[model samples]
Target: MRTGIRQTDVLIVGAGPTGLALGIDLARHGVDALVVERGGTLTPGSRGKGLQPRTMEVYEDLGVLDEILAAGGPYPVGMIWQDGRQAGEHRMFDPAEDGEEGSRFTGPWMVPQWRNQEILRARLEQLGGSLSFGREVTGIEQDADGVTAHFATGEPVRARYAVAADGGRSAVRRALNIGMTGETVDPDPLLVADVRIAGLERTWWHVFPPAGEGAGFLALCPLAGTEDFQLVAQFPDGTDLEPLLTLDGVRKVVADRTHLAAEAVTEVGWSSNFRPRAALADRFREGRVFLAGDAAHVHSPAGGQGLNTSVQDAYNLGWKLGAVLGGRAPESLLDTYEEERRPNAAAMLGLSTAIHRDEARRGAKTRQLGLNYRESSLSEETRPAPGEIRAGDRMPDLTVDGVRLFDRLRGPEWAVVELEDGVFLVRPDGYVGWAGDSTEGLEGYRARVGA
Candidate 1:
């Protein structure tokens, strides 16, 4: 047990998208943050592949939108096949107008989960944030002042606060004894893999429905900016999956379901199998430690809400943590992280489950641009009767006084948005914090937010 007095303002567990994004946000704010990952390297495989329009805005704010756009492509139309022949084309999402309401991104963009994390890691490092791979946290102890994380092999970490972004089976979450209440969204298991195959065009997302009873569906989507295709296959509820996780097993699934030969699959990059489940932590925060990403909520992968929601969780908590740590705001501001994010996580969980059960469609809702915090405690709408845009609504990217709204809202400081109807105080996270016809109560809100 090597021991010394090493400390940071915040200690982030798990170098996934959530932790890395939070680290970047903290670094830019000049907060001392350290990120630790249990693994020796960044996690691989295209686990979450879709980035919604709202997330694109977040990436833009984080200064990685250009690389994200250059590294990925638009979702391809689904090509449905039947009896080894071309059947028809299937559109996965409902058609939405591009750049609606001044948003720069229209629909979902395809960037493999691995590549997404790589970009975020680079940005965090570029911002001077520190991250340590292979630092597996075994236990965590938090007092009234700070959190101390004991790892499996190395010196412990002491910080003013800590976050668990380590995934559904989080070690810190378990050490804290937080309960996860959820239901299985689907009984059948799903096998997802990244592979290289011949004779498959990259123009379409190839879909192969089950051939007969006892068979399951399969889909092969060409991953953008890579030579790999994300292969997904559904298995019968009780089928054994151990034999189906190998390269040969993947080839068998592809050849058995589609019109291709088993030999067409040339390489297998990564593979995994799991049953879809939706669960949420009993609470998002326990004392000085907070749960973000999959540590707080688990979602079925149907509507691509898991990753986006998780990333937003970091975004919501990052600014509050910064404000409180910097002594700009009262510590009470930290409570709003759970108050605002938990409910949204619950809603997205239901939406993902609905889409998985085919009870909902991939439409405007799936894009996540309409998500808001109208009911949050931070939202103060002073008007007796408000119009469509109310306090807590996301401020659009329209130009105000010849300056883009996002450009003005950039950085960790709150902005006084001068709109046509009224003046709105935009939170660093981009939501309208307060709105009034004049600056009458603006000072009070600013004081509360440490602005």
Candidate 2:
């Protein structure tokens, strides 16, 4: 089944949302890329269904944030339940109180993972790039010249570099001998199902905590405003997944809180059993191969930060790779991938590893505002000063010239933000350099980034 080795500027593995995000960024930079997916089918139903403001900002910078928002449902309206009653809700992520100027993603947002993938896919297609489906990359060989990816079938692809945006259990990462060190769990398998119901308002996560010891818990998360929901429940030690198909079976679990009768159920879209894990690859890049998204880190789904972090990983790596390939930036710029993102990934890993039951976040800080990448190549020149958001501080939404990013930010380039005083400079990689009332300090800033 092997064909002659093929060549490309960049080769991406996995066709999930993370891979698509990377694809969109690479295409935006005018870097022709070939993205390959091992799976032949578009993952049915929305998985990992929440997008935070920072994520929205990334999408905005990508230029497709509006289309993405249009396809998404109402957001920041999630609630947690203890037993059968509501316990807490996500109501505020106020930017103004935090001293943020103007931003677009002012609150939390929701969008089915599939729709996000669809948007990125469409963008990739319009940008003259297509995904190679059903081609499983069995192996890879990289040298100074370029990288060659070997597939199980069809022709192999060769590129200047290969990016592994694969999922948590990335085969590419394993093959690279990358060490994923963290808490690996083998808890009793849990049931994860995506289904549609007729009588339910799909707005918040409905939790039915175990009333007694040894009893399993239940969590029903709404997706796309449809009665459809992704349900997760702990199993009694070792339980099989087939029984969930019966209407009575679903009622036995869902009826714990929702008054809806069993007759209201319609379809079961997808179901599986999994034990969540908190893992991080020892390194983000090696030789001509680099890892992005879940390929680099994975955490418990408790925080909904998994998808958000993966998208950010792609954002961090995309421009560095493009710059190196396009000959616009020096090779040393590539090292920042580990510097800026690894710390954040480590923090997320810590959050997931130390999760609190009945809550979606690890700590108050781990929420949307916890991400800060100060000590990066993008910030090495302009150190953090008082009265200004520092290099390692969260890149606050700057309101100047009417461009606002209150959500996930699309990036990989510098954002020339004009401040009232010194004209703050934003690195394309998403970091704030010098922020002053005047541009009187160009010599030091220019020397650091070699601009």
Candidate 3:
């Protein structure tokens, strides 16, 4: 019980993509935030390798898109193998036309999750934000003014608000006594690992279907910008999966399932096993503490929605937290964090589950471009009839007077754009907050949100 007082405007638990992204957002806004991670270092593994177009836009605003794009490449076509030979190509996502208008990004980019976390952590550090690793939060207590978080070691943290981005098994979330009700998307256990293997072409993702009855499927995806391939294997339901995390176990599984020899597996970087499931927290917020990312919603990785949704969760909450803490907006604005994000998270969870069961395809829905907060209390649609884009919808990227819409909405403040039809107020996260024929209610909206 070391007794020292460390104060920050916001305290974030977990240093994953969500916490790191939120730190970057808060740091740029001049908000004092401290990020604490239970682990000593960044979590390893290329578990979530798909970054949808919308997440790319968020990364661009956070000043890390260039690095992200440079570090990753477009997803390669899937190579279906038959009798240890290439059969045909399988497209994982819907194809996009060149030079699309609404988005600068065409489709999902492939970046290893560990590398993504490192990039975000670097950006947060560059912005003068602080992250404390090896500080597992044991308890959290919040009152009228602020919240205090207790850690396994070191002094407690006192902050105006606390965020749980600590993943599905969040200690903070459990401590808050919040319930998460969900269903198992698949009974089959999945083994995902990052490994270096020889004699495998990096040109395409290799798919190996189950050999016989009671067997499972295996897919080896070439992780961009690295020699590692993300290997995913599914076991029949009720099969014991505990032994698959070891290096020898993974090598054996690879040799047994694929055509490659066991010696081709040069190294195993990280490994884990899990049963796919979808769950959402009963509430995203409990008093001054809020849940973001996997702490709020758990999704199957089939559609690659988990990480993207988690990143967007931080994007949505970061500005609101900054605004409220800066005294620029009323505290009620914080309520919208849960209101707008929880429903969106729920939708993604269902999409992910559907994709897991092969009930849905990895198409436009997984890209997350169409997600909006139109029904949100924060959105004000004054138009009698909305056009292509409406209030609460994402502000599509377009050039106006030689300025990109995203460029105009890059900072921590809101911007009003005058299009052909009327005026639209774009939120800091690149969503249209209000739209009307004129700037009639714009002032009131601005004042209320402190935009």
- Top model by lDDT, which number? 1
Which residue runs of candidate 2 sit more than 4 Å off their true CA positions? 1-4, 75-102, 184-188, 242-252, 255-260, 357-367, 381-385, 401-413, 418-423, 433-451
- Encode model 3's per-residue lDDT on 1-451: one tens digit a residue: 2247798899999999999999999998889999999989999999888999999989999999989999999999999998799999999887776546388888999999999999999999999999999999999988988899998999999998999999999999999999999999889999999999998899999999889998999999999999999999999998777787778888899999989998899898999999999999999999999999999999999999999999999999999988888889999999999899999999999989988888999988887888999999999999998788899999888889998767778888888899987799998898999999989989999888888
State in Å the error of residue 220, model 2.
Answer: 2.2
Stretches of model 1 off by over 4 angstroms after superposition: 1-3
Task: Report the C-alpha lDDT of model 1 over 215-245, residue by residue, as the tens digit.
Answer: 8999999999999999999998998888988
What's the CA RMSD for each of the models? Answer: 1.4, 3.9, 1.5
TM-score against native, each model: 0.98, 0.86, 0.98
C-alpha lDDT (0 to 100) for residue 128 of candidate 2: 83
Q: Which of 1 and 3 is the better model by lDDT?
A: 1
Candidate 1 residue 102 Cα shift, in angstroms, is 3.3
CA-lDDT, candidates in order: 0.92, 0.70, 0.92
Candidate with more favorable, higher TM-score: 2 or 3 = 3
Backbone steric clashes in candidate 3, count: 0
